[model samples]
Target chain A: MRNSSLIPFRSGGGILMALIVAAMAFLACFALAGALGASKLAGAWTDGLSGAATVRIGAEEGAPEQQLDIVLDILKSTEGVIDAVPLTEDEVAALLEPWFGAAPELSDLPAPAIVAVTIDSANEPDTSIVQARLDGAATGAVYDDHGEWRGRAASAAHAVRSVALGALIVCALAIAAVVILSVRSGLSAQSANIATLRLAGAEDRYVAGLYQTRYFWLGLIGGIVGCILALGAMVSFDALSTVSRALPSLDLSGYWWFLLLGVVVFAVLVCVLAARITVLGTLRRGA
Target chain B: MILFENVGFRYGRGPDVLQGLSFDVPDGAFTFITGASGAGKSSLLRLLYLDDLPSAGKISLFGRDISTLTRDEIAWFRRRIGVVFQDFRLLDHLTAAENVALPLRVAGAREVEYRDNVAEMLQWVGLGGQMHIRPPQLSGGEKQRVAIARAVVASPDIILADEPTGSVDPEMAERIMQLFMEMNRLGKTVVFATHDADLVKRSKKPTIDLKSGTSSGGVAA
Candidate 1:
């Protein structure tokens, strides 16, 4: 519990400081949640892309069924290949529906046969060796591990994560700035109380502790409010997304809640530290 | 013991408010610092409380030179000397008991350890029944008593009262002076600054006349 009577700051700027902390904490929560969400999204994309490969056999290359059979046999014989399955004509048409629409021409266009191959993540087949085997037998077969597109997707996901993390850091700095300003204003407003304390033989650190404790409580309360609001927002958005089927749900893992808790703790620690430093600096400078 | 030798002080870039003041306040003695307004009575008390260092010369409190004390040492040294400001300076938000407990609180004593002592001190100052009242609700004399109680609560070896009775009626001023006198009898040195000559003369204590920058009335010259 705080010894609030020692400083009498409750009447002056307490509410303003708490509200400011709440607003900054609110911003910080969003930044942290965005960063955590982006990190999970990046992991999902990387995993999905890394665990699969595709084998495309042209229709003009010998008998298309023979070409497909040769490619499937080579992939099945390959080490680290978990499963290989050929896509049906209808499945291929469905894959093309996004760009070509429901046109009958997509099926009549002599599309190449595609074999989906799953690989053991611990050990993937060498694409070079697979391509060589296909080139010798299935003439126009193309072995694509999707490494290029996967790299691009991974890079994009990483950039999003980085941007979110940058935003989180910026939010932290902004919160610290607000804390410093509030502490300064508090110091000014409570000058008489401070002078009385100092004259009463209160050490600088002891006086600073009063401010630190005040801000610590403010930070904790405000951070909790902001975090709850952010969590409610995330849950509501997730629920709305489920109903509308537009954006994906937040889908935060269990450990991500611990990360959110860490954000609250971080805000509190930042406020305590900012108040301590500000008070000590101002007291020393005035001294 | 408080000792001053050829001491001088001034605000930044301004003329000296006090100059060449030399006096010794014997331990356990009650000394009055009497002067007109701006004659440096409060300024001298400020110096004694380590609020401002003298612009020139030396002041030794309890045998340690004030100019040579480290910041930490100065703080620790200040714990031995209590100050009562003219305005009372009681935190208006705190009750009379809380205001009286300020010195002990600042000295790091927990409430459990000092609660009884605070109550007793308030009772000693004749505010036993009004302990729960805030300073704003208290009369001027009651507030001054609270301020006095706060000053002496930490058991400081010396009490420096700067016009502590300046805001009260004569009867209340005498009561305040009696409290200081009681403190002095208990072995705490008291240095009181006031412009009220009648009060000073009535007390008949040693006087440091700041107006003429001289020591008289049994204080060491």
Candidate 2:
């Protein structure tokens, strides 16, 4: 009966089914984004003092060349600190390319001096103690403590992730609503069919089972289609960002499989629930 | 096997469709319910089938009180009875044999056990060669026979038919009525609703007449 009832969901050129799936995909992607972002931020926060950290050395603008020796000397002796090198103009230009495009606007600006710091894997040096040593002599030099900002950055990233997941949940709810409403409307149109079955001694479960079966299939087809579309969109995005690995990106992590599962489940559940209500209501009205 | 005592039913706040309608149908009896248009014959059949509960009286079928029965129980009760509507409510998609086999299937009979019986019933109704034809393809008389076949195939305890012969020719009407009579003789209570005076007089079944909301009549003219 469930299969027989679902024949109508496929009867049309599949309009209702397409919309339902698209909604599922939309929710899945949004929820997946949150998962991706949170995972990345967590990875970044935990390994804050690894191969990636900012190194700062205070120096007067006119005397950077003279102050370079002392800063380099301090960096060499610092415990658990790897090689510290001042950033060249080309490295900064490459970092700025994504924001300003490949043709960087270089005419009116002098490159701000940046230090590249690598800390040892086994331990990270305390930057504050080093900061005390170079304070008075190197006036403009400050130790690069990127970890100071990691907490705030991780907090902000986590916030974005929460919102993305919440949006996904709302999307799931909306998909459920859409499927439910369409199922109910379809049931109304098919009331005569339902009444005939009831008159033929079909039980409430038997009659309602028809609607449930129809909705479950509708949700599934729709979900699979929507997921495929989202996967396509993500693939295209991945292709466009080939050279830039540091910029914010979305990748399907281990947890995203759960989200995909959830999308399909949500679709089926809404359809079943909606169909049950519709069938029971019509039968109750003695139609 | 069916009885209605002081049964009064209304659509809503409207006047009664069937008011104080007291009637009894004995087991295996064939009876005709005759009245002019809008005289509540259909309403009376509706009550007999438990399609709708009467607003104010006790109705019984198979000796069980129906007025206080739950919806599920009423549904089960309906399975013990069969009906043929005037419009010939055969599913347009189902074949003639399939339509006839419906009630038995509804009663949860196994396919292997019912297939041969359904085929015999369809043949008995004079649709021997058109078992595979759908309702749309069948002629009016053929469709009515299909409906008749459907009503009796389950061998229900009672059969209620509303205007069973309204769409068929006189000869066909007589044949269909004979089918109902045969079922009655086999111990199934039967009620036929019609306004055809010729059918009423020809059949000679006890007539339950309704006129201006009363049973015992003053106008036999």
Candidate 3:
């Protein structure tokens, strides 16, 4: 009924415990964000590349317009191919501007004409069938489905998500460890008070509840502090135009806040459970 | 009521502090445990309060063998007994009333329910005016009274005290002894342990002299 802690915890160890939990929660926030961001990025990259392809016609593949027309005809006739559109010479130069930086002599060099093709993801046209048909009409035309690049991007994103999740687990464990140590220290420091309470006929649950409640609140408060800090960092990242562009997929949706709340709840649970187990164990041994 | 049969106790792997002892304290009895500094007086009291199990032999409290009691059952049994520690073991940060209410609090009584009882208990101990004073600010005798108030506030069936009046003057000691006597009058068994021979002789109560390794006077009413 009395909510005050019998064990005095206003010591350096308690502060240190809070700080450690805060640090862990802070890192956990970033790790959770990274995992979520990687998942979203993977979906975007895979979807962007999966259902589309390109057709490249080299200069030696006869007149550019004639080769482009042939590739378009083949794609349009193929089942599962949504639409085929050719790129003009100026559009090709614009695509290459990042690499060539506006070279005036670009027209003197031999460049391939390109055609973009969209396909139904659920029923993609067979690349082999389309490539064979194009090769029969124009020998230098090459069909590209972008499947290889998509797979690599998805793999990279998957690796990032896995690492982030692993990091989150490590942070949770670290928080648990810190709480355990802090509770053990509190027990040792207040061993006399504990003995007094025991002699006063206090149940083990009552004694353990004191520490558990204190540490639970400590963890919850620390988690909120860390989350607030993480939110500030995220908001700042969003405000920075260059960084946001580099990490464009980090657009935190509503689910991001929900997941962060989950982290705080998990942190409090870890603290309460750790304190309860430690105190009970120590009391049992003393008894 | 408590019964001890051939109780032998040792601290950890050390030699026995008390050896081959037996005594029975009937309900509502007031018994004094007497000995020299090392005659196992405090050690024997620790046994009665269930702080430590006997290294050998058996102790039964309220007709239950302590050795067979589970941890929870032990706690439940302990709640029926109260202890006034030798050092007055009040928390330095807590006020006199808070210290006295510990037993009630441990029993899960709400403050609103036990608050008046705590104030009344402190008053009974002559510490009503010092209820809000912390242990550090209270005198030795005041702390002793606070301890006694704490011990009996929960209305336990037994009160075990170890040198409760050792830190106070003779006048305070007598007054403290009166508090225990009052508790006994209320049908609670009181076991007092001390090296104060004068106080024991003055009270003329039954005593178990550990130096003799047996009961001296028979159990008292």
Candidate 4:
């Protein structure tokens, strides 16, 4: 606290550094949000589809009604099948209502018969065996356990998360670089002051502490401002469009305090570390 | 308290500034190093302060060989020796009291413990009323007094001054020399480097005259 008077209370470069930290923190928060959102979406999709599958019966081979009955019977007898229900024609039409516009012409279309199958967690049935049995019992029958689509969704989410992580890393590096440059400039400006301190028998830590404490507070203030701004922007954007609504709701209200605390702590640490290294390096070289 | 054996020094790749310099100053002695400008008087004092190491000779202080001391140990040694520069070198932003309290602060002393001592030192040097003023607001003589107060406030064992009276008038110069003499009388070794032959002759203290780099003659009393 005594050395606080040795350094100027206000530096233009310090202000600039704080603003840069704020911007970086803002971008970092958004990147983290993107990563979290992607992870949540992937989890939701996996949870919705993990225990269910669908079967399609073609009308080209035998009578569609007969093929449906045969496929339903086979699914019911399977050990892992919890329930297998064949879809009525009216239900199939309702499923296609969104695309067909509820027109009477939808009834004339050669839509295949569909059966919904739920599997028990204790006994997972092999879909390949199920499809083979269906083919033998009723030609042109197909089984779909949704594995391919789930894998693709997982891979897409992973790629998005990776990009978000890459963005966060880039923001961190930029923040550190800004802090280093700011501290270096301040040191160069105060070289004479530093010499006076050194001649007074002050150690390297003493001099470096002056700058680190200043930058640490600046970083904390900037980080808080940035986090608030980012959250505000998210809320505004979510209100303006339906895209964010379609994704899983973040509900940051329950955990925002912790997130803000994390951002402030991280920012302060980066600033202090950058300033310490810069000051120590300069002093060592001068020595 | 100080010894040098055939000390030699030079800037990087430059010719020798001081060579084959050998001398010793007894404890509690008042010594003056007199020379023309650039005759290496400041450079010699710098060696004693460990600011610059001897290039080709050995130097010892307080009975410990300086060449063997680590950087931290050298800093500790420096804390015991006070240095006064010609430029005053007071931080322009700090008040006189703050400037005088710098050494104690650097040593990590609590402010409440040293506040009264700093104020008493300032008053002793005749700057009691100007303690709250910054360096830029003080006169040149007053600044020099503040610098002297700062140098001696920590009660360092040795005080090294480089041209302490170079910028002040004759009356003020004598007053400043009286301060250093008073400190010397109190058992602190004082080594002053100056080009003022008149002041040197008036004091009649032991003087080391340097002409090029080597000592001109043995210590002249």
Clash tally, candidates in order: 0, 6, 0, 0
Clashing pairs in 3: none
- The residue pairs in collision within model 1 are none
Q: What is the DockQ of the complex in model 4? A: 0.48
Q: For candidate 4, what is the TM-score? A: 0.88
Ranking by lDDT: 4, 3, 1, 2
Please give, as one word, the docking class of candidate 2. incorrect
Tell me the deviation in Å of residue B177 in model 1.
3.1
Model 1, position B49, has a per-residue lDDT of 90
For candidate 1 chain A, the 10 contiguous residues with the lowest summed lDDT are: A1-10
Clashing pairs in 2: A21-A222, A57-A141, A58-A140, A58-A141, A58-A142, A59-A140
lDDT winner: 4
What are the runs in model 3 whose C-alpha is more than 4 Å off? A1-4, A11-13, A54-117, A124-143, A242-256, B197-206, B212-221
Q: After superposition, how far is residue A74 of candidate 1 from its true place, in Å?
A: 6.8
State the TM-score, rounded to 2 decimals, of chain A in model 3.
Answer: 0.81
DockQ (Cα-based) per candidate?
0.44, 0.23, 0.45, 0.48
Alpha carbon lDDT of each predicted model = 0.84, 0.73, 0.84, 0.85
TM-score of 3: 0.85
Candidate 4: segments with Cα more than 4 A from true spot = A1-4, A61-81, A101-110, A120-139, A242-252, B62-71, B198-205, B216-221
Error of 1 at A151 (Å): 2.1
